[model samples]
Target: MNWFWFLLFSFTSAFVLTALLRRYALCKSLIDMPNDRSSHSIPTPRGGGVAVVVTFLVALSVLLFKQLIPVDLFLSAIGAGAFVAVIGFMDDHGHIAARWRLLGHFAAAIWALCWIGGLAPISVFGEHVNLGWLGSILAAFFLVWMLNLFNFMDGIDGIASIEVITACLGACVLYALGDADHLVWPALLLASSTAGFLLWNFPQARIFMGDAGSGFLGIILGIVTLHAAWTSFMFFWGWLILLGVFIVDASLTLFRRLIRGEKVYEAHRSHAYQVASRRYRRHWPVTVVVGGINLLWLLPIAVCVTWYGLDGVIGLSLAYLPLVLLAIKYEAGQAEAG
Candidate 1:
């Protein structure tokens, strides 16, 4: 299987399909209209995520038919992704109960855990920690956590796309260094497709990912990280660093919502990205800032994965320090200013 061919096909197919589907979604009135609680003020076409779904399914299907990747992992990940996509589409079209959505998330997570093998124990700084029977449970929880984080962070235009691209680049770099096969193609495919989608999703957005795009991308990235972790220690550390931005922002936002009188489970436009977008008065800048940090800073730290082995863990820790401080300061400022 030539990866070059696969990457080209993934990019070309996804871009073409996104353009065509964007028109279709608009024609069908599958759009997200601005609301009092929305960061976006204009009604934009939604469900372009069907492009992401179709692209990943097609490329992965070809690979599976040719036996280029593991059938269980490939099929199971798609199933989980599709499950979330369905629920997201439902939410985009109409109101969906939180409990029902949470139930779907749990079902997808369990499927991923059962099919993708349990999480590999972490052996850091010469200390071994075997999760034993608990590994499967953690693995399932990780899947659900990542899915929710990505979904939560999808408010602003182009933010989620850029984050996913940054993560895929980090994954690709590690795979290149180690010549890792299990994760390389999937990461590249995801990055290319997301890049194509970002064209219309940036400032003055033309379309929204809705829950379908964000949730499915989340599932794909989470599963890819797990697959990478199983392959090598370098892959594991790199995935953590790649995802730190989203993790910190989403976790802090949720915590603050809890602190406030707001219902944590309800929808709100209080994410750091949403706040920054309103303050900065431009969507593209926030998107660019995130992409820059991930590409310029996080990607470099991910490269350290190859050398010093797990010794480069400190770099990962340092990379997240600024993001943590930003989250804290941002939340505080929001409270005072509001």
Candidate 2:
């Protein structure tokens, strides 16, 4: 597959562009100013994710122009990504309300559902269950939820970018193993772009993803994972296992918020990553923790697609372990401090 050069090129291109654009955003006032909910002390360039969007869309467009992908799926996926990116960009600059973000997400979801022609309810060990129209609706909601979760999780330096890179690496490995060819390109493109953003973001914060980048990335990665899941029962587990970090942190936090009667829709710096970042009084430590988990831990599971053939849709559900522990510890610490 000649993936050696491809991977190298994707990573290098994304990193350089991300670093340069980040500096440009800072000079041009495309920065996220410090506020109450922000952990960053200084004004940082926002929307460095434009580099991600550019690399992904441009690469995908070239592939499409050369007739490399299936016409229907390629166009639909790219269209949805572009649509969401515009909405996110507006929100980043204009601080658009939540309602508007939901509207755009819903619209993009419906577009994806139409593009994918509905999801097939997947069971790994049991019989495959198709929920018919209900499945499509549920899939849309799940996609939107994933998108928002990714956006929410981007509150700290390198968290979202690292997660995105992990997801891409997972997809790329699967692709190299002949799991799914179509899913690999988009994932690698986004992953490489994240490499670019992380250079400035990690160690010391210089720029942030803002809503534009995080939301767009979440939606793009969400759709790619959805596409992989529909490939078969085995592929579904691969995608889920890849997303363990994001789903666990976001799902548990939302559950906690719901239980506490907190305003779930409002912005709050209460995510486990946020809590750890604040508690530790450093951003890179939390960033390194996530990266370490992804590299040392999650990467092992991701390799399961190539090694043990552990692709049951339910097996990947076990990816919640670290999340449960981290959440419980973080919550307990918060209580203890109070």
Candidate 3:
């Protein structure tokens, strides 16, 4: 019942499940082929995220059953995460209509919030702001966006896995520092499980996570942020700061696409990290660079935000400003195939 044991089991489970899924995908022809919009150069077995999700959920349920996590938190996260993963799994093997995906995302978001007891007054820069009727609507939008952005950033090898590890570790750090030990286990489990996947995903990816894994991560993380905010309003800022890399890249790229009259829903490799990967002609460097930024740059800034409970908005902007500039420098505004 100790966390370390659970962590080890989760990690090993994910690693073994990934291997099995890879072979299954190969046999099933579940492969992702390189295309004009893709970042990879060869067909690779995909749907590895299913292993990640299944292992994660199984571990999470054990923790919940043991009363390590609250009933509501467990229920909300499990319910929504499983549903989103199913949608993603379906999408990974074949095509799913955009509208249906959107609807599923909205439903999952609402399902989580409903179980988690809905959104409270949100904060910006240590100031309390109320959303009233618009709260649910905006929260749904944010949840959907978070899930989709993870999908967007999952283009290159190991990036999504790296980001999840960083954020989950950040959550553990913040909780430990704040003396909220009860909240640390979920983050620890998530980080370690993803690390198991990262071993096979990085350097040279043997398998891709597909839509199922990426979308599952997004929903879980979105719920995590909301739950953290509920725990301490300042915690949301810390969580966001931890996720700054993907948030900035995805948001900036989407904004640029909207400005340039591009279809926002279409596939493209124009994200900031994607641009950097193209520039370097490899995925590792960009992945390392972003991982470094999360650790060296954002982590310290996030600690300040979570610790100070003041100037979170300012700290967040300060943390993101450089990433935005870097995206611009790399011409993330331009469409790939330009």
> Which pairs clash in model 2?
15-196
**How big is the positional error of residue 7 in model 2, measured in Å on the Cα after superposition?**
5.3
TM-score of 3: 0.97
User: lDDT of each prediction vs. the true structure?
Assistant: 0.79, 0.74, 0.87
Which has the greatest TM-score? 3
Candidate 1, lDDT over the whole model: 0.79
* Per-residue alpha-carbon lDDT of candidate 2 for residues 1-338, written as tens digits (9 for 90 to 100): 46566556666776777778777776778877787777778877887777777777777776677666556567667877888888888877787788888998999988987887666676656567888899888889987988899887888878888888877887677666755676666677678767876787787767787777787888777677667666655565666677777777788888877877877787777777888888899888887788777767766676674447664643565556766788777762132242
| C-alpha RMSD for every candidate | 2.0, 2.7, 1.2
Evaluated against the true structure, the overall lDDT of model 2 is 0.74
Candidates ranked by lDDT: 3, 1, 2
Clashes of each: 0, 1, 0
For 1-338, candidate 1 gives per-residue lDDT tens digits of 78777777787777778889789887888877788678887788887776787798788888788777787778677889889889988887888999999899989988877777768776576566778669778878788888888888888888999899888887777787787755677787888888778777876578787788888999888887777677775577788888888988988887777777677676677778888888888788988899898888877877775554645457677778888887776562144343
Model 3 lDDT at residue 330: 84
Over the full model, what C-alpha lDDT does candidate 3 score relative to the true structure?
0.87
TM-score-based ranking: 3, 1, 2
Quick one: best lDDT, which candidate? 3
TM of each candidate vs. truth? 0.93, 0.89, 0.97
Lowest lDDT sum, 10 consecutive residues, model 3, at 117-126
